[model samples]
Target: MTEPTSANADREVLQMIPKPATAPEIGPWLWAMEETRRGLLRTVRGLEQDALDWRGASGEDNSIGSLLYHIALVELSWLYEDMLLVEPPADIVALLPHPSRAPQGGLQHVESETLAQHLERLEKARADFMRHLTPMTEADWHTFREPPDTDYAVTPAWAVFHLVEHEAGHLFQIREILRRWRAQERAAP
Candidate 1:
């Protein structure tokens, strides 16, 4: 057989192994979260305030800022309310004071905020999440949680996975918003 190409070797070498930034025991989960965060930041780098507040022609009402706020809220909620089963700390509460979902599941008002402010909120919320997530042992990562009066159950691992997935979904939405905003600008006089 011919030797494998470098691209094939690179693909084989690629793995989800954890990095040193996280606690050794819970490294994989934290690494996933960090990777997701990096993807989000990469997608939105240099995004302008007006572009961030743009809603598409469909009147969907989901702007980049609102999605950023929602992403941060979901991660914090999953960690505190779902995994740890405790109240969110004061700093997190201050960063996102409103309920996670709006009255009609539409976007809440995020126009007053700047892109930098929203990014700062996301970073702060993520720092708090890491602080709480780092202490868990391997067994704790697998611990299941079932909130009162609900059949829904999840583990810390699933919660971290959900955070990553949540940000990814919204990252797509942000990119779409940016694309539409550019199209609108091009179409205008």
Candidate 2:
């Protein structure tokens, strides 16, 4: 695992604020998600096709491309299923062509798709999610959905928080994978 670095105390803008021109009530959450996503994009920037598709020698772990697809899929799923209390709309489903999990109960391994395609899917999912959130009222933000099939309920706020953490965790995994892949490439004869 990578070690942490100290923040520069002199930096002027270390605060978290809502995204600009967004609803004041939900802007903080939006900003947090955006920042988390920025970190994700930074971590994966400039990855080539082999880097995106690389699985460790064991071939059991997810490829970076798979993780990227999973991230986008989960974001849209949470937005529609947990927050909106409905099935994902047709367009959102269209954005994710694969099922969330494979028949063997792992993240479906995504391959062959270019990094550009993965980024496009992520961008579309995020844009749709933000558009839905931009007009939310305070009440909408707090309202909880309790699906009968599950024992738990979630407010939109909680769902957004979960989404942020979920993506952050995967971003860490992607970083580790990239590091390992580079080392493997260098060691190859």
User: What would the TM-scores of all predictions be?
Assistant: 0.85, 0.89
lDDT of 1 by residue, 1-189 (tens): 355467654565435768553447678767887887888899888888877877777766688888888888888888888998988768778998767677887657577688788889999988888887777777778889986666899988887877778788888877788887888999999
Candidate 2 lDDT by residue in tens digits, 1-189: 343355876655556767753447688888889998999899888999998988788988899999999999999988887788778778878888888899999999999899889999999999999988888877888898886588899898889889989998999999999989999999999
Q: Largest TM-score belongs to which candidate?
A: 2
How high is the CA lDDT of each candidate model? 0.80, 0.88
Error of 1 at 119 (Å): 0.9
Which candidate number would show the highest lDDT if scored against the true structure? 2
Report the error of model 2 at residue 75, Å.
0.5
Tell me which residue pairs clash in candidate 1: none
